[model samples]
Target: MATQPTMSEKRWLRALGATLWPSFLVAAGASIVFFANIDPETLRLDSLPGIEISRMSGYAIGFFMFWMVGLASSLLTLLLLNPTPERGPWH
Candidate 1:
């Protein structure tokens, strides 16, 4: 047997899913499409010569960077969708 989640917990989980799931999917597709055209090794060598980063590591880093951007976009959209209360002293 398991206990049911409270309403707040459920809302939190829903918000988490809403934010992450779509972003993850978009990041996966973007990674494939972008990396297909651009070689990470060449990009890294051209951009950063001092650091030693492998091709696979570059892909991972790119994916995470895309994911972070997606997350920020998603969060901003969420914030905009939420209703703002009116500012007043009396209700």
Candidate 2:
């Protein structure tokens, strides 16, 4: 007989998968931005007009923001996905 995953195993795997997905998305986005010569510093996302930050800091902020956005979108999609119905013995 086949065995199902334990609750602890499922939770650990799920957490790893969740983290990896967002990390991969952010890494890919960073690579694309780098290749495209996009400057994160040029982005005017500051809440205060007089405030300034370094390019590295801008990139860091952008990375975290992208990861959060990707995570939320993925979670929403996952929650919306319906499971398949079970088959009957007669079918």
Candidate that would win on TM-score: 1
Q: Which 10 successive residues of model 1 have the least lDDT summed?
A: 82-91
Global CA lDDT computed for model 1: 0.83
Candidate 2, residues 1-91, lDDT tens digits: the string is 9899987677657766865687668656865676367666556454535668877786777777767777777666554543444531111
Residue-wise lDDT of candidate 1 within 38-87, one digit each (tens)?
Answer: 99999988999899999989999999998988888887776666656562
State the C-alpha lDDT per candidate.
0.83, 0.63
TM-score, candidate number 1:
0.87
**Deviation from truth (RMSD, Å), model 1:** 4.6
Off by over 4 Å in 1: 85-91
